[model samples]
Target chain A: MLKPLGDRILVKVDEEKEQTVGGIVLANNAKEKPQTGEVVAIGTGERTPDGKDIPMTIKKGDKVIYDKYAGSEVKYDGQDYLVMHEKDVMAIVE
Target chain B: MLKPLGDRILVKVDEEKEQTVGGIVLANNAKEKPQTGEVVAIGTGERTPDGKDIPMTIKKGDKVIYDKYAGSEVKYDGQDYLVMHEKDVMAIVE
Candidate 1:
């Protein structure tokens, strides 16, 4: 199992959409990188200057939107995951 | 003054560096867009599903690293500023 440390999270990115709003077939080169993903794992929390733990509001299985260039990309067991700090997550899709 | 709305923030990006760590002069086209900036203005907070406001931890004048494509770019009085969600800011440069 891959466990993240220090407020880091692992995200499984969603599949890319091949068509645009106008139904144009965008080539792979023209497709904008996706920013949405499903949370896989997360750390407990981040430590503050006072040595207090700031608990993360995000949890596993949440659908999230993250920053475009936020995380370090890694492939584990043939699956792609983005490992990034909790701060990079934009919002939770409820 | 430009005021941000609903967890949005305005950031002033730092100047671009012309040289690399290896002392190579990088041209404008070769330079990667920077992710670090100083906070300028910020919204009060984001409302929760229950209608509670979640105050932001980021304040004006803070130096932060944000997602590369996270914000909308705007020029205010000859200065370049990025308008992005607080979530797009990855970390505060303390």
Candidate 2:
């Protein structure tokens, strides 16, 4: 299993970007990739300056919207994943 | 100038990814973009829980190495830039 360390969170991006306004597939040649994804795993929370463990707000299975390029992309088990810091995550999806 | 607001930092990625491993230009079809850059600009300090301004550790013109794919790429003024949060910044290079 691919587990991210520290404040890194592993995201499985939802690949739903397949249409365009003109009903043509958008140019993948320049697209920066998707930003929305489901949390497959989360790293341990950050340690406070006082050495206390700050619990992470996000959990596994939480759908999140992050910056499009805000993480390291890695390949594992024939699947692609994004390892991002918690702060890079912008909002929690409903 | 492309000034990133909040904890966002603007990085001018060093375009040093034009070499070959075996003297053959690596395949651009699957390789990710570069991960090293110079901090062209940095965001304001983060707000602490007590409302104090926690100063940012990074400064402009500092060379930095960040996780590959860990920022939103934007084209502004005919140049490429990455907008990444402070926490996404991994290490400061000399």
What fraction of native interface contacts does model 2 preserve?
0.03
Reproduced native contacts, each prediction: 0.00, 0.03
TM per candidate comes to 0.51, 0.48
B1-94, model 1: which lDDT tens digit per residue? 9999987999989886576657878566653443678999999777667676666767899887665677999998999999999767655555
The CAPRI classification for model 1 reads as incorrect
The superposed Cα distance between candidate 2 and the true structure at residue A62, in angstroms, equals 0.5
Model 1 segments beyond 4 Å from truth?
A: A1-70, A73-83, A86-94, B20-25, B28-34
lDDT of 1 at A30: 52
How far is each candidate from the true structure, as Cα RMSD in Å? Answer: 11.3, 10.6
By summed lDDT, the worst window of 10 consecutive residues in model 2 chain A runs over: A44-53
What is the interface root-mean-square deviation of candidate 2?
7.6
lDDT of 2 by residue, B7-93 (tens): 688998888666688788866757664367888888775666776554566789877657776899999899899989867765454
